[model samples]
Target: MEDGLVRSISSGLSQKGVRDHNERLLLSLIQRHGALPGSDLARIANLSPPTVSAILRRLESDGLLERGDPVRGKVGKPSIPMRLAPDGVYSYGLKIGRRSAELVLIDFCGDTRHQRQLNYDIPLPDTIFDFVGAAVSEISGALSPEAVARICGFGVAAPFGLWNWPNTSDESDAAFQSWKDVDLRVRTADISGLPVTLMNDATAACQAEHMFGRGKEFRDYAYFFIGAFIGGGVVLNNSVFEGPQGNAGALGSLRTVGPNGESMQLVDMASIHQLELRLREVDLDPRQLWTDPDSWTSLSRYVDPWLGQTAQELAKAALSTCSVIDFEAILIDGAFPPAIREELVGRVRRYMATQDTRGLIPPRIEAGSIGAKARSVGAASQPVGTQFML
Candidate 1:
C-alpha cells in the first residue's frame, strides 16, 4: 500500500456538494491503499469521524464498497476495513497496437474479468472497429443483467500518429492512412454503446504502473514503455500527468545521433521492432517474440545485442528527461516477458552508471510490475478513474 500526504476534502463546499467529492475521494483512497478502516480514512482525508461514517454508510448501501472482518485493537471497539466492491462497476479497455489489438473488461478493482486479443500484419480501421463491436457484444452478453448495467464506459489506447508507420504493401499503407482522420473516442463509443475516453497507449501503460505497479514509491518519475515503438509518460506528484493535448511524454521523439552520424529518434534505437527486423535478417521467425507462451531462449543471441543497445539509448534518454524535471525515478516496461524486462532494467542501470552526472540527482531505474497487459489495464482504468476517483 502507498502512504503519503493525500489531498483532503475542502471545507469551502456545501455539505450537499461535498458528498459526491468525498465519496470519490474515499473510493480513490481505498483503491490506492488496499482496505482501510473509517478512522484511517478520516485521518487521511481530514474529515470528521461522523462525516466519514456517513459517507462510508452511503457507499456501502450503494454496493460500491464492502466491509471486511472486524479488527480488534488494543483497547477501542473493533474497527472494520472497507474496500471497493469488485463487481460494483466495470469498463472495457481496447488497445490498438501496430502489430496487434487487445480488449479487456476490467472490474472496479482493476481485475481483468474477460479479455481477447487479435494479431494483424497491419491495423486497418474497419477491421479493428469491427472486432471491437463484436467483442463487446459477445462479452457483455455473458454477464448478468445487473452486471451489464454497471458497465461504465469504453477506453481506447492507441498511438498518436498511427498512419505514419510504413507497411510492406502500398495497398496496406493506403488502408492504414485512414487512421489519420479517425476519431477513436467517438468511433469506440458508437461501436461499444458506451461513453469513451482515448489515451496514448504508452501513457495508458504508465497509468497502470502508477496505480498498480511500482509507481507508488515515487511521487515523480519518467516512464518508458517499449512497444513496437518506444513511447513514454510523465508522473508528477503521484499522478499521471497527461498534458493539455494528452501527449506530454513523447519520449520516443527525443533526438539522438545514429551509428553513421545521422540523426534518429529513441524509437528507432530502442524499440522491439528493431529486434524483429534483426531476427528477420537471420531467417528466424519474429512472430515468436509476440507469442503468448513467450520463449525467447532460442533468440537470445539476437536479443542480447538489442538489449545492450536499447539500454544505452534508454540511459541517455532517462538522463536527458531528468535534466529538465529532476524526476525521482525512471520506470521501464514493455510488451515482453518479465525476465527480459529485468535484464533490460539491469542493463539500463549499468549503462547509466557510466554516464557523466556532475550536478544531477541520479534517478532510480526500476522495472515495471505489469508485463504485456499494462496498456489494456491502464486503458480500463481511464473510465474507472474518471467516474469514481479523484
Candidate 2:
C-alpha cells in the first residue's frame, strides 16, 4: 500500500529531486482528502517529519497552500492544518455540448468562481470560439492582477465526434461538419491565450467525480455519464486509464439489443436523447430537460420508462465492464435532477442483482455527486493536474 501510494500520487517521479516529488505527493494527498497537518501528511506520504515540515513551509510561502487554524489536541503542540489556497491557481473549463456551451472559471480547489454559457439548437465552431474568447476576456478583466497571474491554463471538454450529432438539418449538419477539421486545443489556446488541454466530455465528467466526488472510496471503477448520449471512463490503480490512444472506456459503444432484437450500441437505448425523442413523439417540449430548476415532475411519465430502460442497459454494460476489468464499483451520473439520479441508480442496482454472475464479483453501483457540472469541472482540473499533480 505504501509503494502504491507513492506511485499513485506522483508516478514516474522517483528520479527527480526527492523534495520536488515529495511536495507534489503532499499536495495530491491534501487535494484528495482535504486539509491535513504536517504529521498526517508525513505518515501518509512516508516522509520524515522534518522533510514534511520543510516542504509545507516552502509551499505555504509560495502561496500554493495556506495554514488553517491551529487545532489543539490533548497532546504536545497544536497542529495547524494546511490546505490548497483557493487563489493559488485558476483555470477555465469549456464544456461544449450538443445543445449548449459552458465556460467556467474555477479555483485551485475546483470551485467555480464565475461561469458563462450559450444555448443553441446546434453547436457551431464560430459561435463557440466567439463565446469562449469573449467570456475569457470578461472574466479575466474583472480579476485583480495577482489573481489573473495565477490563471494557469484552459481546458475543453467535448465529444469525440462532434460533427455527427443531432442530424437535425442541413445547416446545422454543415456547421457540425466544420468540427471534423477544427483543432480544438489549438483554437482554444489561440482564443484564451493560455495553455489548453482538451478531453472527452464524458471522460472529463469522470475526472470531476474522481477528484471531487465518491471516487476516493475505491481503487478502481467504471464511470458512466448520461449526457445527451451515454459515455464512460475507466480508472485503475487510482488514476484514470485513458489507454494508449486516450479512449479507454468507451462504454457507450458497448453492444446491446434494441427493442425489436436489432443490434445496437448502449447509447442507442440509454441516452437522454431517447427520452427527448419520446417527448417529441407526443409533441411535448423537450427543452425543459435542459433548462434550469432541474425538476422533471411533469415529464415523469416519459422519464419513468426511460429510466427503466436506461437502468437495465446500464446494468448489462456495468457487468460486461466488470467482466473485463473486475472494477471495484460502477459510478453513474448525468444531466438530471438528484431525485432522478437516485431513482436511476436504484434501478440499475436492482437490475444488476438479477443478472448471472457465476464467475464475477458484482461491483457496487453508486450515483455520482458532481451531477451536470462534472464535465466542465473535470475539464478545468486538467491544467491544474498537469502543473501540480501526477
Candidate 3:
C-alpha cells in the first residue's frame, strides 16, 4: 500500500476500546444468532440481566441496534428482541487488483450498499488514488449523515508488491518499479484522509468468504481466490492464519512439479494470469475474458488445456495444505464469471478425487459463494471486524 495504516489502537483509547469491543461482541452475537431477546443475550454473553439490559440500552440509543415489537406469550412480561440496525453503520473497502480497483460500501448486515469498479491495464499511483477519491465521493451519496458518520474507515486489500508482477499484469518494469517498496497504506490514507487498514488481497478475500460466504458454516478450510494471480488463505478452527508477515495462505507460492516434471510454483499454472497467457497464445483478446466473459466464445476450445493444468495444480496445492492441517472443505473462487468458476471448481473436485488420501480424509471441494467482490468485501469488512472484534 502506498499509504500508511492507522494503528488499531491509540495510546489513550484503551478504555473506550474495551467498551467498543464489548459492544462489537454483542453485535456479532446478534448477527450470528439472529434477533435475540434480552434474556437470551444475557445468557449467551454470560452477563447478568442488568448488565445486558444496560448494554442493550446503550446500543439501542446509539442506533447501532434496534428492538423488535414486544412478544406476548406465556410470560408475565413480553420480551423485546434486538438486532443490528442496518442503516446505522457502514464501512468502506477498497480492493486493488493487478488490473483494476474496486470500492464497496457495506452495511451492518454485510450487505453491499454501493460498489464501483474501475479498470486499467496497470494501476499507476496517481490514477488509483484519484479513482479511490472519486469512488468514495460517489458512495457517500448512498449514505445518510448518520451512516456516513458511522463509517469506520477504509480497508485496503491489494497484492503485496503488486507492481513487481510485470509479467502477470503486462506492464513495463521501469514504469512500475517506482511502486516497489512503497508504503501503499500510508500513501492511500494521506490521499483519502481516512483511516486505512491493510491486508494481503487473498487473505482479505478469504475473510470475505468466511464472514459473508459459505465459511460461516465451516470452521476449518483451505480457501483459494484465483484472481489475476492465484492466492489464498488458510482458516484453522474459524480464524484465518495470517502468518508472521500476514502472508500465511499464499497457496500460489506452493511448489509443485510441472508438466515437464520441473519444480514450479502453483501460481505459474493455476492463476487467471496464466490462463490469459493461454488464451493469448491462440491470438485471442485476453481482456474480453475479464471484462465480458459471455463474449469470450473461444473459452471452451482454448481454455481446456488451461483448465486441466490449473485443476491439477490446484489439487496438488489442496492436498499439500491438507496434509499439514486437515480441513473440512476446500473453497475456490476468482474473478471469473460464475459459470466459469463453477466449472473450474468441478474440474478441481474431480481431479482432487483422483489423488491419494490414504493418510487423510479428502476435504469437500466447492466454489465459494462470494465472487469478484470478495476482495473488496473482505477489505471493507476489516473496519467492521476491527470495530466489532468478532
Candidate 4:
C-alpha cells in the first residue's frame, strides 16, 4: 500500500511539471506569432504533435485560447488557427505627460479595449497623483470583476528623469522637491492593487511600434519620439536597449550643433513645443492651429527652419549612433497627426539626402504606424506582455 501511494504522488508531480512546461511553450508561441495553427505551433515550439494537441485541448478548456475556422490551403488537412482569447486577460497602461495623461486598457492580443485622456490645468504635484489614482479606480470600476481579476499589472510611461530612485542625502532632498523622484511604482501599485512597471515614455512608444507597428520589418533601428519634447529609444537585436536604471534612450537633452554652429539640445529644436510656442508668439493657439489647414501650413512654415536644423542635428546623432550600432533605419514618430508626421519625415529625408557621414550607412527614415497613440498603446501592452512573458 505504501509503494502504491508513493507511485501515485510521483506520477502526479511528473504530470504537473509537464503541464507547466507546455503552458510556457504555448504562451511563448502565441506571443512570437500573433496567431498560428496547432500543427504549426508544434513545429515552432519543438514539441511533439501529440503534446501540442494535448496542450491546446487543455488551454481551450481553460478558456485561454480559441480556434478560428480552419484555413484551407492547397495542402492536405485544413488547419485551425489558434489565438489568445481577447477577454481571457487584461492589463492597464498609463502615459503621464507634462500637460496631460492617458489611460488605456489592453487585452491579451495587445488590442486597446478602452482609453481615456485627462488634461491638467496646472502642473501641481499632488494633483497629478490624485488624478492618476482616480482614473485607475474609475476605469477599474467600468470593467467586470473577472476582467479586473485577469489584469496582470499596470505599465507606466513617464519622462526619463522621473525614474530616479532616491538614495543619497542630496538626492533624497532633491526628490522631495521634484515629484518625478518619488517612487511612483509603490504609490500607483498601492492604489491600483496591481504590479507596476515604469519605463520612459519614448522607450515604451518604440516598443509599441516594434511589436505592433511598422518597425516590425526591421530588427535594428532608432525610434525618435517627437512630442512636447523630442526623446528617442534604441532598438538592438529586435529588443529595446533599456540601459542600467532604465534611462538608456533619453535623447532630448543631448547637445548637438545648430545651423549657426551653436550648441543646442534636441528638445529645444525638434519638439512640438517649439512650434506651439512659435504659434503662440503670433497670437494663435496651437490646438486651434492643429485643426485649421491654413493655420497648420503657416505653423509648419514658421517651424520649418528650426525643424530643418533639428533634422540635421538628428542626422548627426543618428549617424554617430548607427556607426556604433549599425541599425537598419531611424524612425521618426510624434504626437502630431499623420499629416504633420509625414511632413517631418519628408523634410528630414530631404535633409539626410544632402548630408554625408563617414563609417555609417544612412538609415531609412519613416513614420511610425501607430502615430500619436504609440506611447499610450505601448503602456497598455505592459500587463498583457508580462503575463505572456512576451
| lDDT (Cα atoms) of all candidates against the true structure | 0.90, 0.89, 0.82, 0.74
Cα lDDT tens digits, model 3, 109-193, are: 7899998888987777778888988888777766678667888778999888776674533346665876776787897788667
* C-alpha lDDT (0 to 100) for residue 167 of candidate 3: 59
TM-score head-to-head 3 vs 4, winner: 3
lDDT digits (tens) for residues 203-225 of candidate 2: 89999888888988889999999
Instruction: Estimate TM-scores for all models.
Output: 0.95, 0.94, 0.90, 0.84
lDDT of 1 by residue, 64-139 (tens): 9999989999998999999999999999999999788999999988889999998887889999989988898899
Ranking by TM-score: 1, 2, 3, 4
lDDT of 2 at 160: 85
Q: Give candidate 3's TM-score.
A: 0.90
Better TM-score candidate (1, 3)? 1
Each prediction's RMSD to truth:
3.3, 3.1, 5.8, 6.1
Best by TM-score: 1
Off-target runs (Cα >4 Å) in candidate 1 are: 1-15, 166-169
Which residue segments of model 3 deviate by more than 4 Å?
A: 1-18, 69-79, 166-171, 296-298
- Native-referenced Cα lDDT, model 1: 0.90
| Native-referenced Cα lDDT, model 4 | 0.74
Give the C-alpha lDDT of model 3.
0.82
Across 1-390, the per-residue lDDT of candidate 4 in tens digits comes to 122112344556565655665676687667656778888888776676777788788888877799888899998999899888888778788887655678888887778888877665223456667877887788888988888888888888887554342223565445446765578788778878888988889889987887778877788898899877778888888777889987787777677766588887777777777776777687877664334545555666676775666676676666766777778899888776677678778877887777776666788888887876788878777666655653
TM-score quality measure for candidate 4: 0.84
Ranking by lDDT: 1, 2, 3, 4
